[model samples]
Target: MSSLCLLALNHSAQADEAPLTLPTGTISAPALDTQDISLQTPTSAGSRLGLSALETPASTESLSGERIRQRGDRSVQDAVSRSTGISRTGTPGDGGTSLSARGFTGQGSVMQLYDGNRLYSGMGTVTFPVDTWSVERLDVLRGPASVLYGEGATGAVVNVIPKKPFTGEIENHLRLGYGSYDSQQQALDSGGSLNDTLSYRLSLNRLRSNGWIDRGDSTSDFISAALRWQATDDLAFTLAHDYGDQQPMNYFGTPLVNGRFHEGLRDKNYNIGNDKQHYNDQWTRLTSEWQLSDSVSASNELYYLKAQRRWQNAENYNWDTAGQQLLRSGNFAIKHQQEQVGDRQTFTFKHSLFGLDSQTLTGVDYNRIRFQLNSNSPFNDALPDGQPLDLQHPDKGRFDSASAYRAQFQSTTKQMSVFAENRTQLSERWSLVTGIRRDYVQVDRDDLVDGSQSDKTLTGNNWKAGLVFALTPDTSFYGQYATSTDGVGGLISLSPSQQQYDLARARQSEIGLKQVFWDQRGEWTLAAYHIVKKKLLTDDPGNPTLKQQVGQQSSRGLEASLELQLPHAWQLQANAAIVKAQYDDFEEQVDNQFVSRSGNRPVDVPRRTANLWLNKAVTDKLRAGAGVRYVDARYADLANRNELPSYTVVDAVLSWKALRNTTFGLQLNNLFDRQYAQSQYNEGQQWILGEPRSFFVTADYTF
Candidate 1:
């Protein structure tokens, strides 16, 4: 064992003054076990012990609905920003947010699940909107989870669990808010049980704002409803539907020397445009539990998800040649549409074999996705004479006249996976968890633009093993190793005639410690991990402007987090991470030097990051909180020459419960009005001014 691992075990032993004890009965019955509740830990359905976050062998984080509401968070982005080893990469044209965990960006690298159903598998667009009103809790599982989820889970998995039906009286909450820059928001949530077996919940939200930038406006609308039916004590059915539409400002790249900060907005004469984005998603699930005998039981879950999205935008640029400045506009438009429909089923059987205790879990999942894209553009050049043209019919000057080209690409992907996991207690203080998974993938692409067709198929096998040792009643230490794979197709080629690339493989190993102190009111965790990805995909350096994927990269890192519930109704939370990601054993076309020898940092990845938050209750009905975030400087490209400056941002909030069932809250984002860029590709003329110190005041009434 490594010295670091020994240190972790030693610490665990020191924290737990009491000896570990095992329960006598089966682990499934929760009423029989006693343990402290820590939001950072995972609860075992069988162990009955409500394990504190410090007791779980793996790295996990939880955001309770109450905590979310207190933060005045409007979206998942707002909630995830506080977690460790997490970041958001804004999408182009559309204001869609994609999550990055550890050192890997979105795609299959990070798994997104809604109610146990895989939501992002083969999904064309990387962004999804989840209604906060319907969320019961958000669980984050860090590190590789491919053994249970099957390929594409190299970094972590985020599970959004929805609220369940209540058996008692009906509940309702309505909120309205108005803020800076003419921003307005309204939301409503209501839920009730219809009968002994049926219950439902509905949520609605709307927001509009005349943004800080010129001609930059945003409008959003969302609606979601859920129904739960418990036909029997062991059988349950759930159905859900969600829809949303958004129109927000879109900005492209600008010259560095542009003295004026346009905030990514185009000048009136630039004739640039923004985008209109739309989304709709729905799902249904059925779960059944059966008790065959005293020591044996069975459970199964079936689920399906359907999602679709569309996006439509025009950009402007200035070209200077030979001391002559020429203004040009690119009237680019793309009709991108995608649909994902899939089903997943899992079954688990619990029993004791011989003198050993174990439960075998088996599952199969299948998913299909249809994606299509149509793109066209027209270019117009301005005259050197600086003549004002007609608004409806602009003149095509000395440069190339209006040129139009369109292409239609369609693709379909199907994936099926089978997995099994078993947990066994080797001794009173030691336990082992082992699992294996196999996945089959098939893809077909059709080029409507050229009548060309192509197909590809791939198969992958992944597994995981971990050992957990309970050093004391309140502390534990664990070490694990896992492997995962990601299919490479979307970024391979724009033309359907090209052959699909081989799957990329990622292997990760981690050791960590979890400990609880102060009667479970405080919890802390530290983990060290190394990940090596083979045939990893990245852009070609020689042709930076082209959209293509090259292979071979790796990343290694360490993460630490602490959550404390202090005296006097105060809470403090902090997370810090350091990562080093780079290309491995690969040579770029620009320079024949191997990437490993060059030692260039991965693009868009920061080496160090940290976040701290403090909250206090001023009175029985009043509360206040403050937070700050820091990100280290990072290289914009693999060469490591262009560096993005490091920055820190601060935020604060206050809330008052004026009445028994009424509350008022105020929030200040970007309290320092810091100007920073989230990613290297961000095109705004200036650093994406972090929301410009906006303020919002809201009133909420609950029944």
Candidate 2:
């Protein structure tokens, strides 16, 4: 009983399976599989099946769901700007929307996850914004994964997998879109299967845009759901949920030579007259899974999120004896509230010992977070003869202001891990895979403003070892070593007595190569890594200096990726990243530097990056795609003498399947409207222009 009536009696016994006819030797096939039939597909077991740009031993990238619905990407930073060692910093008024893997920038050491839990606000420092149609796949795990996730991955780990529900029948989809400074979007998806152990899925999304500069505007909405249950034949159970909302539009900073790239003086009335900024966000999640038997299985998850923001600016005066030109106004308010509750329990086991082939994973996790921040400012200087100014009468009219600020913080994190994995075949050509993991972490932090409060605590231990080798059967080679830790933040901007800096450690080493050719339609990967970070938390200058932490730094890297599936329905992919970061000793602000020798290349890092996509399937109801992206020069501060010039962008897509579960799509983004500047300061400038070439025409149906 219950569990949806035993999943409707296992979906009416699988709809009473009928139609069957097969005689003549009763089909005994697969004898021509002499060459091992490409190791029997399914990615030769090890259940980590490709995608994420053809997953290798490490360094990953993926954006599928039909290439994110043919590239009309609306958020999640437009699918992480099409990968390649990602970079997007301090979006939304100087401290939100940060991601900088490899050279590690914001959110400390990059780590954001969903579906596998951990979604920010555990006092690991802030950075949260996700609502890309509830993402259905986007895993980019490169470098440190903190031994099964814990601490801020010293520069990598972003998983957003969501979208599950399939068994038999019932499927639906709907999408609508519009473009250019008056954008609009709508999406909906559904799933079925209510018997034989049940199945379900639901998704909804909405987005609106009116931006191209000048107080850029935006709106977002989302909802997601999933469920699955099976009571026997080895057992099963699952549940999931997510919700979202956002309102963005607050492009600040102007001055950089009057904000280039004309668009009616970047939205007329110039002179910083019409200034207004806003923010509102919400999030939620819950999950559960179990199959406790026949080798064992278990999982559990829960999450919650909230946010708020507001700002305004306007002030100027000239009057020149009433000749006109005077407008003054000011108001600023920011209130952020966040709460998080976490849980993760995992247990897995498999068989075969002496003959090798084994698997064992054990986990325990607990997290608690509470946050609050409030700020306010109001200013007015009266005129119109209502009288207010006259503070020794140096100018003529009104002047009055008020201010208020508040802060509260709390955090608790606990994690324990133990894992074991092994696979040994050593004969039929040879096979060997090994794994080990050990982790333990505990952290606590509490900081409440004025009322005088401060507390901090930390403990850590991490380790990981890996090895995989398979010569034939599609190739394989792997090597890994890991260790990670990072924490300590009280709103970083430096100088608040450098916030008692401490806690930072990282050590990583990787070697990889994996390949699957022809039969599987082509795939290639290559990786090389070297990382060393110890107590590295720089920026300290006498008397607390607003919190600072430092103790050495080192990073070395090389990555390569390629994907090809040509011969009719063509497609090609590419990725390349290189890093060499320094400063492993010596400190005297710039006088005793041990490295960094002013060779800046770690701030919004970019040494070289590339992307190319081409797809074609002319007939069978049209299909076309084109793409190009490149980056090289970057460094807009960190004392690299300002530089951010190196840009290339192009994109195109057209898809049609006229009928049979219908589909029609058209998209063109940044098709040659380039003009870059993704960050800058010294008054203001943060442009990465070229969003004008947008066109969307989508129609999808499945049932």
Candidate 3:
């Protein structure tokens, strides 16, 4: 665990205004026996006060690893995009796999966190923590999370929490599986108490696949290990490390034939035979917590991260009707090497304020990131116009270059932040939660090709306030308002031209209701929110020849989720969201001229998304489950002229206990073999199709 928030809270019940003593004596680990009941579970990503999902006064979802496996979700993206108000917009191998939430899109808006620490993207790309095998749970907070995190989180924050060490009987878990397209998966997890005051946990996973498309083979490996020591009754320390190495599929997307899908070309691979994409990452963290007194506690975390990524391929393809060939462009080779170090310290106070119970938290965070890039752009090495191949049958030629890759750029980013949060019980039926955060960021860039340099310093201030009212012992209503910010582009890779603009600013207002009924058998939540963003760079309205930061965009949406455990050993889970997203004032440069895009929906921002899952226990050792997912149509370009059609897919799973400590399962994905675009590239000219019907057989054992 990278955060001390895992220390469970201890409330005083002597009186309504009794002082509370938040304890840090024992670690709080989630039980692996249950798959539901997230409403009552505490999440560190949602709040620093150790509040449960229902008490956070915001929309949060906690999906356990067991629940995800039962649903047959293999990738982190597959599990996270199923939550309310979220949809995928890119692929992991494309240097970045981004998402759209509320009204915001891309890596510059939605952030990713591993073990409660940010994975700073070098150039708008995040390629670590891709697999879900090592994850314990995923905590999602939707809409304007800058008050809890920091900048670049106007859309949402997805926290990937790995399994942690626990003091108990030694246990070991092993899983092996085989799926369609010659895919194989293997995983192992072991943990236990090594001594009276020490515990250790380790996880390993490997995956290999001969993908559904031609020449699309991929492999990945992940390892995580942790050790925990309780020095005294009031102090504890934990050290953890994670490593990942991946070689993702070399396929980009299929080019459209006459601006439409061609079923005949769905399985074609139109790139050099040696196309490559690789990512390697390492992360290490040490965390310590001390209970200074009954009413005071402190914790600190120190961490380091390193990442290396490389790509070489023909990324874009254009159809040539007359010539009966496909013209490929954007042929490039690029590399990124990044290193980061950071530390976070927090102090917590639990006492009475104005004769009411109050919990206050203050924290300071600092991190420095260094990044370097190497690439062969402008095609100075031959093949400047790109390669053309026959439409029907083509020779997959080898990658040929006359010169070696050259240094492109190197940059450094330093940031410091201070934040405070407080939760107070105003009365028996009402409470207030508020937080404030400020960040100072500095970015410096050097262009190796031209010997150009640029530097910029930015400051961001964020705050949020909310009120929660207990309508009943099992129901609550809440409302909140928050502010956030996003850089115009990836901060670490900011170019000289982009350094002239300030970070975009955004604000959001939300209201929600949560309830648990039917004797803990059912739970539901509903939320509605509106967000507005300004300072977007756009063409000057008076003079279309110039650009200015006077543009605006907004979105309003409603989201709902429900989970129920019915009679006769049946379970149901469902969620849906609808959004109205539009640009109030925006423009794009086309053919050296600016065109207004006001009132246009942002590209890849779907208006509606929904998911439903149902499971039944047929016998003491047998179970069955099925799920459905739907995504509405979306515009593929700012002009709103190209549209990607809506799609729906279904999946099913069955499991049987074959032994006392072993289980066998079968999973069928894309049950209907629905043919639809999962993502797009080259301004929607190319479409990455979704997987066809596939099946897998898996065995899981625990000892």
Candidate 4:
């Protein structure tokens, strides 16, 4: 979504000079992005009525590919976590980006989309740990998005858009870099026209590194290609495919020293030496667009996805100070193979009912997925080698190779939804938008633990209504109410009890103001929201063995963001968020007794977070940037007894242009080298440490 270029043209007329002629592929004058900090008008993550960000009546933002490359962010995590109101879990180089937003986390709270399509994965993990080099844009929509994306979005939704093809002369971009911990990076992008009506584009990326901790080495590869055919002036078709593979380090976690982190234990890896994780993913899609008329358009998108995942490691590690050794347990291994196919059809047209300008959008979507799981559930023992694990020095390949994987569960899910929306411009400054959707879902599960089969079905109807009023050419105020739900049948396997209950649902009301001031050089947005969720499952009062659907939760918060394209080629950006997430009414079993947790704050959700970044152009060809991020303390358990201290980190970057079309970049991360715990798990016995100071030098060339 981000790139930069500057174009200028001068013309002189003396009888036209015999109709001047230039290069074969050059025409008109150059009009491009003159600066790296300027924001682009987003086409997605909004009302779909072609409204600008100030008129969408929602909180939405986008980061472009050029911005990502300028900052030297290699992975999705590196690019996403720095955005306002966003946090992530998992260690570095783990091949996964688990994100949190609006004080919510996990599969039922957030949704991920690839090029405007859903992946429909709910296995507690995503196999595709994308590389930023292949991305064209990443869009974010905060709060509920089921109105446009179907079910399962409560906190937010992220959309990753890849590069497409264009009809022009061949173009190429290459990058090579070296960094801390013996890391290496290589990336390539090329695209051009094959004929008058055919065009193609390709992207490739690879990263390898010996990480900061012992046995922490990782490798990743990604490749994508697309073909576009301009069949006619009114119709076009696009076909694209992408493949990825990863062998990320299996550094589960470091052992906690006396319930706290110790400097001496920062570089330790307690897991068995043979531990590792790997995965492969593939995706293919086809799209068709037709300009039916000047006022009407239609489109269709179809896609198929395949993935295979594997994990093997001593997932749980504990420190035994008395014995002077580290004890490893919870030996785990599992495999998964999943496939999904889906199709979407949309139509946009103009309509009039009450003598006003009205726009209408209608769409239908359908998807199906088959998931299978295999595991060694009853792990024999952590010490399968029958030898005590030495704390200071240990041998490699101490794994249990005799274990076999057996089918644990199998599931098949199907969903279909239809949606329609209309926007009516009643006056020059006032507009109203309304939308509604209906979704039907079905789940079929086979329990391998017992010889049994179960089927579940659920239906949901959601709606949205909003109004926008413009006070000036660049200022607007808006308010909206929206509804969403969690899949009733669940995205993965469903139990017999889940088939008898309804799906949990939520609704939110929000108001906000958006303005672009300082002669269109600065933009600001602010919003406040209150949300309530109902029909969550909890233990029944009369029957201890049964469950009831009477649980509820609520979250109230405020968000603010500001960006300035200041004078002298200097830019500044900042954002902050504060929230209170509490259980409205719930009860759980504790020590053989059911207790109330009606006012407890949810675990893993922080109350405050903020970010600030500044960049400047020192001269015609030299630039520098710096940023800082602060994350407040977080409770690791529901009881609020285990707390992880807060921490702040800093980063900086410098770039110099040495040639006409080449640049050298040096990036420094965690400049202060402060140590902090990203998170704690396994009853506070394991800790994931944040990375230390690191730097990289990159050479980029364009042709």
TM-scores for the candidates:
0.83, 0.29, 0.95, 0.91
Model 3 per-residue lDDT tens digits across residues 633-661: 88889999988899999999999998999
**Which residues of candidate 4, in runs, are more than 4 Å off?**
1-40, 91-95, 319-325, 378-397, 400-404, 488-490, 540-544
Top-TM-score candidate index: 3
Cα lDDT, all candidates: 0.62, 0.55, 0.86, 0.76
Cα lDDT of model 4 by residue, 487-542, tens digit: 54346656677778887899989899888898888988898998888887777767
List the candidate 1 regions with Cα displacement exceeding 4 Å: 1-56, 93-95, 121-124, 252-255, 258-271, 280-306, 315-331, 377-407, 489-498, 537-551, 591-598, 682-689
lDDT for model 1, please.
0.62
Best-to-worst lDDT order:
3, 4, 1, 2
**RMSD in Å for all candidates:** 7.4, 24.4, 3.9, 8.3
Query: Residue-wise lDDT of candidate 2 within 462-510, one digit each (tens)?
Result: 6555555657667777776777876654321212233355557888888
Q: Residue 146's C-alpha lDDT in candidate 1?
A: 73
Greater-lDDT candidate between 1 and 2: 1
Q: Cα lDDT for residue 346, model 2?
A: 65
Among these predictions, the greatest lDDT belongs to: 3
* Candidate no. 3 TM-score: 0.95
In candidate 3, list every pair of residues with a backbone clash: none
Candidate 1: residue pairs that collide: 27-46, 41-53, 536-552
